[model samples]
Target chain A: MSMFPIIMWILMVVVAFVIYIPVAIKINKTGLKRLGATAHIFTCDPDKDPIK
Target chain B: MSIYLGVFIGYFAIIIISSIVGAKKVETMGDFTTGGNSMGLILGVGTSVATWLSVASVMGVPGNIYSRGVCAITGWIAGWFGGTALMPLIAYKIRRPAVPTRTFPEFIHARYDADKDVSPLQIVAAVIELAGYFVFSFIQVQGFGIVLNRITGLPFVTCCWLFMIILVFTCFGGFQSVARTDTVNAILILIGVIAGAITVVNVAGGMGAIVENFATTTAPAVTGGNPIPAGSLTSTWGVFGASAIMSTFLSNSLGASVAPHWVARFMAPKNAKTGALQMFWVVIFLIPIFICIVIIGMGGKALMPSLPEGVTSDYMFPQLIINYLNPVLGSLALVAICAAAVSTANSMLLHCSTSLIYDIVRNIKFSGGKKATVEDDAKTTKVLRITILVLGVLAVIGAIQQWSFLADGFTYVYGAFGSVFFAMVWLGLYVKKMNRPAAWVSLIVGFILYFYCVTQGAPFGLPTFIVSGGCSVISAIIVMLVTKAPPVECYEAYFSDDPSEATVAAMHRIRRDDV
Candidate 1:
């Protein structure tokens, strides 16, 4: 098995976790239904209550 | 006759019974469509994985691996894993408002409407979703036809009709039943694939021997390429070259994230935490199954050097099961393939129905177009069920052909969803000033460009996804920069305000039958 592809997969996973986990944790903390604010992932409704 | 009848009948009975029991919960559109947005983490994970693993992953991936080697994993499987990993970032947003949206297209309708009523963007988005998901459901029915023909010796067309009957019973229970039934299917798939992998590995004289044989085996000449030489198994881009591999990876990863059935799963979760956690568990569950997928395909190649005169790589799994494993065990494995296909087909059908009845029809009837009354909701539920039945029959008709257009059709289906929605959903979700014109232009361009590429064989070896997806993103961005955004309140409804909070609290507190 070439380690190159496996390593590339590992990197992709790491990046996904880095981007997703923090937002997930924030959503959990706010007790809010929507992300309630954008740490990341853009919202089409940008004109509304702008997250700090 | 080959040990499938008794097992399949019993399996179908359990699915029907559970689906009926779950159907008892469907008193309103909320119940039928999003399960009242009350799905627990367990069912959420189960349905999500079952929906994600479809016939394509279970049957198609193995076929690819058998023909093209490990590059299949990089091209297809890796993209799925990668795409799903990003789902958490959008899960909460997609399932927005404590009240939750019934379908994905509803989100587009909610976000982009100008007067807080139905808009052209909403209708167009829902129509695209309906068309795309309808085709997806057809492919799953075709997959079921393949398996049924193998087991029962029925004509392919007859098998397609038989599976269509199964879909009605399975889909009639609505989202609640679909989620519950999916849990059962997911468990079966996990067990079947794991067992099938172990049996394939052992039959081929262990993993090391299988690997040795694969490295030295020569591929038979097929329509796509010249015979692949020994040791070329290690080459990432053998006959397909870099572009083909990249195309698979792009469509599988990017296109999948927006697949209607997948987005529908997020809507059913009990809460944001439930949705977010679902992705984690999905990845956990998929790992073993995917490893098994690789083993089955690669191992089959090791043992059989060349398929029997008429067989294609698509038959590798069923061939391994029947020819190698004991009868009882093979029957159990076959159930897994059935489970994978049924779970995906039912979910796709459900989404298609919801888009037709819940998003499009319901939007037309509502004044603010934001909420549906109890009577209106009940009427839509009836419509949704009827739609599911009618769509099931249409899918059966699509499956009557002998050739499994699944491989090529799968790319077109995913690419269609990606081109039409990927830009719209992503931009609609994040970009501040993406105006209606931008959304419209991007959608139209992506739709036309994708079909054009498909018609021309994806010129220069470029995948349909890159052609369409690139057009969607680039055009949306360019247009958004020049066009004025929609009104600020439109943005608030989707992003800033908790519009569904009162309704959610009322539903939880009063349990009102009347809307």
Candidate 2:
């Protein structure tokens, strides 16, 4: 009921986003070239892959 | 009552159909274990969020908040967010390897054992995973049974067995089935929690009223116990002291970051970027779900004030639904709990079976041997299915006992995992100088300290995981300094941005040619 916990929760969410989003973006940009075709074993086929 | 039953039946039918569809695509061990390492962002995010929002998060967290106060937010939610925040680095490193290991233990072998033999380190990791996930699976079954028993008026044991059937059906189809069903479960959980939160806010009049009631109410957490002091629920640490709150946060967050199931999840993504992105998205999405849970917990306090005599706080969520909400909405909320139970239970069950079959049994049987033949893959897949069934029965037996508080179960197991693997996984992936002796010593030191903390009590009442994890890092650093560095080949797959052709070939040789 005190706003402290809510404030703390929001702070944590912000901290997580700040830490994760950049790393994710960097990985997305560089990851495919780094790993190349060898790692891409499964084709992204909806019928074959578990999730559509 | 009939509406609840119909909704439950419909939920189970949907889950079964999804499993059947997922099972059709499983032609090799890779499909069973890692969803053929082809998960797109949506599926990856779905499974990760669903698995993360275990019954502990849905039921235990609210119950903890209902009983203790907002400290549950710091102890569980914040720590979990921190853990997820740290996961992109892990995902990047883990998925970077050209030939990824299917299981966590296999990754250990591939990283630490230059010879790629079934080393003691791999066996120890598998054993820990087996023990940890077995406990995790038990907790899920216990939570599921508690909810279903409350809803159906069936005997508790009957509800547990019912959950076991669902768990086995979900897990028997392996990672593919688990991931597919998990996506559906994730959606249901989101809707259910949002609806429950909205209903709670409405019943309590408004957010302001709920907050005022929660702050001023002196309701005892358990009936006939001492009333909670007024304003304590709104205090900085809530009812729990700083030490207890910090311990809970550290144990849940740090331990979960390197948890084997999460590591394996990183492997399932289509690429390194997807793995990292999925976790980022999962963290974003869980923000709303956790906020709703907090609202539900606080609002329940405003409405109920205190629970009935002899009833634990774990019953708070279901009791609220039964007492306040309409049948249709209540049924949906109950089904969400079921979804949480099934989504998490299947992942843990898969980890248990895979750790047993692929990590321990096969690693030992085929030590110093060639890569797995097509026939070996077929045989291992069959054995993994059998292990899931057997373990499901064992978990049902364990659940019948109702060992401890629902969320406390995770704290203990996560402590053990974080203590041992926090150094082993994180340092092993990044620190090329870390040697076999360092790995063995850190594991031993961490496990001993963890055991001691659990048995004798941790110093200053800190969580066992914090003490043990600290010791693990210190000992690992000291040992790494004194011991010789591991062979270049051992760490190259994880550390190198672009590993040499020879190193890639070696990595390929270390893993089973499952596809």
lDDT of 1 by residue, B261-298 (tens): 67767777766656766886687788888889889888
Chain A TM-score relative to the true structure, per candidate = 0.42, 0.47
lDDT for each candidate structure: 0.74, 0.85
Superposed Cα deviation of residue A51, candidate 1 (Å): 22
Distance from true position, residue B343, model 1, in Å?
A: 0.3
**Which residue pairs overlap in candidate 1's backbone?**
A42-B429, A42-B430, A43-B429, A43-B430, A44-B428, A44-B429, A45-B491
DockQ of each: 0.19, 0.31
lDDT tens digits, residue span B1-515, model 2: 99999999999999999999889889989899999888787888899999998989999999988888888888888888878888878987898887888889888888888565567788889999999999999999999999988888899999999999999998878898999999999999998998899999998999999988878889997778898899888776887788777778888888889999999899988777667768878888998899899998889998898999887788899889999989998999999999999999999999999998888888777766567888988999999999999999999999999887888888888888898988988898778898788888889998999999888988987766778999998999999998788878789888877778777776766674533
Candidate 1: misplaced stretches above 4 Å? A1-5, A29-52, B114-116, B221-226, B365-372, B402-407, B457-463, B497-515
lDDT of 2: 0.85
Against the correct fold, how does model 2 do in TM-score?
Answer: 0.95
Docking class of 1: incorrect
Backbone clashes, candidate 2: 0
TM-score, B chain, candidate 2? 0.98
Interface RMSD of each: 6.4, 4.9
